[model samples]
Target chain A: MERTGAAAIIIGNEVLTAKVKDENGPHLIQRLRELGIPLRSVETILDDVDAIVDAVARARRRARYVFTSGGIGPTHDDVTVRAVALALGRSVVRLPEMVSALHARAGDTPVTAEGLRLADAPEGAVLLAQPGMWFPVLTVDDIYLLPGVPQLFRLQLETVLARLSGTPVHLVSLFFTLGESALAAVLDRVALDMPHVAIGSYPVFDASLDYRVKVTVEAQERSQVDEAVGRLLGALPTDSLVRRE
Target chain B: MERTGAAAIIIGNEVLTAKVKDENGPHLIQRLRELGIPLRSVETILDDVDAIVDAVARARRRARYVFTSGGIGPTHDDVTVRAVALALGRSVVRLPEMVSALHARAGDTPVTAEGLRLADAPEGAVLLAQPGMWFPVLTVDDIYLLPGVPQLFRLQLETVLARLSGTPVHLVSLFFTLGESALAAVLDRVALDMPHVAIGSYPVFDASLDYRVKVTVEAQERSQVDEAVGRLLGALPTDSLVRRE
Candidate 1:
């Protein structure tokens, strides 16, 4: 399928209420950008089956790829599998291989009766195989179910995402320490002069000069980005600099 | 005005593409919740003046207090002041007191540039009074313009948020370690039993555990919260606990 953009559904109460800062969206966005894909939006929701199902449905309809982080766990709140199944209208059942793999991983934890349910997945769903690993690989359709854990999400996506590649996006960032009020006229002038190079300004609080402006140049060709940044930076105030990423 | 809910808008390209992790939203949400305000949503937008204006306008209509973080630096991308002017249809100009204050703060150095126009603010807007600060303090209606720099946003809010003493919110959390599938039936029982408490499930990922479940109960009374947690915890799969936080 021709890919357009990807979105993320972060399902966890800890994240929504500022209990934990989410890192998956940022991590995925960087990877997607490198692959030349655009990240559309991120929706953070509480750990409710209906909410997850609703968010997934909306994300899939809006984006070419929808990655769900969190909720694919082996606990009371790990409702991703069931919710995904319900969202897809599939029956839930235990896969033999997953059960065996989980049992092997647990050793003597009564995997069959207690932890054996980890093997359960929506009927007809392909198990991703996670024995002594983070997440079981599974692809139902456009959705990729990943562990809510940041490390597990990163590890699993590194392997699964290799199958899906995206086109490169030309982007540039312009950092500025110039007070925003004082730079409006220059920004307006630069933006009016160059609309294609995508001149973006970001405020860096880390700079001692009060603000740092990073002007990024992105284009199909590196030269076009360079030329655009050159022109845009020249039109801006004394503090603008063009940099390549 | 009496507090109802809180929300934040992060405006910047760095966050949009994952170039920088946004810290303002979570910081605000955490502090707001501790003061008993529920967070409705956190939105991230590009560095377009019109976009920022539109978002702030919308937030004013939805939330009791809306905070805009970013674009208040000494750079050309700092369009926050102008955007606030547009949002409220107010003419912006350099306030005399503000320029002198900033000049005093900047002292001698590259910081002085014909006042740097850091004082441009929407006409008749309430100055947040971070005097000597580059970001303008503008309170147009209910929306508050803030610096995207995490620490600055935190400090600036402290200066203005005291006027909005929030009502108290009673809440409790219960964590379950048993895999989600193992606790569905019992969770259903808890939901049926706890009718007054606002129950929400939070699925968390632990590096060592399968998945951790946090069940949050919010109510008017502490006893209600405590009872909800007790019942909710008891209803979970046996032997699944990580302690309430």
Candidate 2:
């Protein structure tokens, strides 16, 4: 119930319209899991300002950290910065550091007024310099503004995750030969009894699969997970369980 | 500005926890696009009751049709019916048709009390008999509660989409050698002038790609899209133009 995990908001119209597939959401899910951080949610919405604001505000209320992908570029659809600022009730201010960086990068060519829009960010924003890249990860009040591009998103995500810590959850999986209908009662009992341990029941419809239902019991403490798995094993039909890991 | 698009709520802890990759969201997006229906958003949230309620409420306010995936089963985690009911300000009730179908399918073996939970639905629910399947598609209002299983989700989606109508959007993709920052001014001008047409600019970071940015111009009318594309081509530098489709 405590808001400890991270939440993601992927801002892209191309993905919703089927012009492009979203690779950032899945990648973020995998990375967050690998880092032992539990993810609260992933919302893929259009590149609209109000939608981004709503998503970011909701995500902030339910999570300690919020990460938004895309809509940070210097174009018409790039409204993430403005939206995130609105959500945080902050003014969009041009970062002098970013302006200097852009000027330095441009060198001989003058940075256009539109191109200088990249220097803008929510007030009190912090920039985490990314190695081997010019654009730093723009962040404010635990909300990370990540690029929509897959490669950049992955890189910026690593930069953000390095600063956070989480407890790794210990899990035990039990696969059964019987279906969910036969296993629901027992699972309900264990799940209800062990509030600390998270129990998940998934049924496989494919006949080719060896197991019919996959039950997962997980907890921050290994002992709790093991105890719940033991109780499940004891209550379930011995012959019905195909394997446990 | 009107609520005309479809929105999706993917209720699954497995997806958020990285236990399983979500295939249903992408499949739904692709199918909705093929059906010429605009997708408002796709939110992947936990199986928590309050989470489902909040997402459903927000989705209903934004889109005409809402599709929810997962959490429809005979287990404790299967709380979609209860959550959706609360969202719609309705009560959960047992569907007599579902009860009869369960009885016919079970035959000689009696169904468990927990198994009978599958017969429960939100008030004023309708069951669309799925072709070649024993179970039917559970729907209420414009919300379709689909199974989590990939195959079942795909099949049920087709059945739901068949009943809906949409106008196919006319799209024109233009690839350019110039980056977003270089083309932002022209794009902003055309995008502001042609409010009916939607224009998107995306930058490519990879050097392997031939183009620096891919610009998308789309509208329900082909003439609007073509006019926007022509305006963009005319405004942009002739040498910087790559190709258009």
Candidate 3:
């Protein structure tokens, strides 16, 4: 299948172990949505080479773009670069540009051997100049290896997203007084008939809310979304629909 | 490999589309940590059957318990039950217990066919009686099928968690004034020496914080954690060490 959307892999042991609540995954999801780039999945895994390799390879197979958060530091746990290289069947190589950049940043101070780990990347890697940051974005093919630091992740993400293009989906939501069980058939029929249109049914449990369920119809074109919504509204009882947006 | 921990699959189109920030994944991670169960991974995928099946099968292979959130309702989008059944190579069957419970809940009113869809589950599924709720926790093998609604998910999760057991990890944190580049070598040595202990190095960019990096040492035994911490503290520069916790 042709890859279209983006996929994210959050290599965060701190997040999986609950030491830190993951800000990157949610932030990436929100930013990707705002950019109108459809996201296929967001996987949170440990900072292990095998797991990272598997996740990266799987993401590449399904998504046009793969964004990885965390595991991009000098520490031993920072194995995303190596794992990603293995996933792409490439050897890890020290990028001369990154080495030069590190030396420039260090100035007169001698860069430690461990510090030079920051310069290592997949054999064929490109660096995108980042504004206001010493380290540039590390990218190979369509995969972007981002630092786990929330601040750094945000800044680098902005730089990467600026270069990509997306088509924003047209969406309409219908609020219903009836529950999913009451509205399932009509939704099933409309969703089945308009396979291109993406339909979502979300049940709301809050008694304070006026609606019981919220049905969303979305597609690349406004006409498809509108047509699907119209079909759903027509098939369902008029009294059931509280409002449509 | 012996499956000892838990893995989660958050089947959420709304989450992937950024219509809703996923509360369930974070909540599950926190709860699992509190319960002393190590979490292997948490994958958030769109509410699609192929995606759900792939994720479920993968989780089962790596974890003793697999928890899936969302796509458990009556609508066309609610395909978790069918998908999970396919993942396990089982046929979907309506549970008599759930059907009876639904009938009892409906009382004088006739239950819709869509409403009875809630009774469907993978063959040989068991329902754990959920206290203070009409629905019980649905389980086939070690997979727990949970609702996407935050409130319902929380309540059901508690019921399921209470039935399982876990061993809390022994953990210690060390604060350093030095960055990861300065600490990588020492950490690498300690981590390589003791494979049992999980060592994590997190760099704090906030200048307001007293420490530049926070290192976590953890294992099943307190002595192991303490030993790892001691090795780390001994190897790093005395002036770089800020504190320990």
Candidate 4:
């Protein structure tokens, strides 16, 4: 089975400057994993138009779905929409519906020229609308434009995920007190035996925690993952295995 | 003055799967900022050789320096060295000095075949040796290969930073109770007036916190940043300004 490929572009200078830690990349990673789309790559780039355009174009070529977070706000730094449009050779135009929505939402407050920029997107882009959402999500070609705010990004992602479907991967994880080196040989053997399964070994070195390595087995077939996990468990020393509920 | 550009490649499947939250990207970002190099891009790619090569080559073209974290370990997944070599059109070769170091460090512990893989690097790569460090940091061309462990990556980065230099950027930030929309016009005006300084406005929506917006000003000179900050402070509504030490 061919796995669907996905890539994410996290656009913000705050994230790159380390002033604001990114909550979007990790959130999107988990969501893509749960959706069974193999997130091939994630680029956290500065709020530069050239960089944004290059990242989006590269991601578009590499993956079936591309998600971008940040730079959609009404500010000097917000340029993702225009960048995406330029990258895809499309022109950015203001949507009348979004302008009217902003007008309706702004009642007592006056909408500035910058505020109206939020209504603009790549030509032919689709706006995703849902009840109670203050703003609609924008989709241009295969790229999904999402807000930088963690709360809004998560909410919009859920709505986006509902419209997309993918094959779910079966995964099994086993924790071991033994170091990664101790399990390397057995993992290599198991991996060679099961070419279809993807095996990963992650070491967690915490003085407070007893677990040293977390070995994960993933495959399209549940039986393949289970078989690899069973073999891995049998190969490891019983004393090193960490049993958890 | 032109700013020196830097980019990072975070190589691992664990990170892409969300099984591991990346500590490397944030750590590197902070370090690069302190070192005064303008980090342009950060790519978190899987442990695939092609992906690693593509990311490294792209970063190398865009930035003066490229730092890659992870995939240098002694395992099936550790392919950073080879991938980087391929990307740079070089061949991977085992370094006798590294092998000797590994042997010396192993003492009573037997060095497995996988463990010996740590001795390999790109043909033209230079290993950075320092006092008190168990293993030397690898540098092929401009790409610095760092370990995934936060502690190790930080240590290696400090050593790496000592050899490099960049013009420092001065920054000043102010918090305000006023929302982003309320301050947008003033910020636009300030940005227009101070072309050399970069102004950014970030909104924080927390019911518990009084501060709604955090405006940051950055420039090559401290005076320029301070000038922009002064103008911004004077332009905002006095009642909405949040005083901070």
> Candidates' DockQ values?
0.28, 0.90, 0.91, 0.54
Give model 3's docking category: high
Residue A179 displacement (Å), model 2: 1.4
Query: For candidate 2, lDDT tens digit of each residue in B92-131?
Result: 9999989998889999988989889999999999999899
Q: What Cα-based lDDT does every candidate model obtain?
A: 0.67, 0.93, 0.94, 0.86
> In candidate 2 chain B, what residue range of length 10 has the lowest lDDT sum?
B236-245
lDDT accuracy of residue A158 in candidate 3: 96
Across A52-84, the per-residue lDDT of candidate 1 in tens digits comes to 777676566657877888776555556888888
Model 4 alpha-carbon drift over 4 Å, by segment? A1-3, A175-186, A204-212, A230-245, B1-3, B108-110, B130-133, B166-168, B177-179, B233-240
Tell me the docking grade of candidate 1. acceptable
Residue lDDT tens for model 2, A98-177: 99999999999989999999999999999999987899999999999999999999899999999999888897889999
TM-score of 4: 0.90
The first chain of model 1 has a TM-score of 0.75
| lDDT of candidate 3 over B1-245, digit per residue (tens) | 57989999999999999899999999999999998999999999998899999999989988999999999999999999999999999999999889999999989988889999999999989999888789999999999999999999999999999989999998899999998898999999999999999999999899899999999999999999988988888887898988888
lDDT of 3 at A197: 94
TM-score of each: 0.72, 0.99, 0.99, 0.90
* C-alpha RMSD for every candidate: 5.9, 0.9, 1.0, 2.9
Write the number of the candidate with greater lDDT, choosing between 2 and 4.
Answer: 2
> What residue pairs clash in candidate 2, if any at all?
none
Of candidate 1 chain A, the 10-residue stretch with the lowest lDDT total is: A236-245
Model 4 C-alpha lDDT per residue in residues B83-180, reported as the tens digit of each score: 99999999999999999998898898988887788899999889998656788999988889998878788889988999998888887888889777
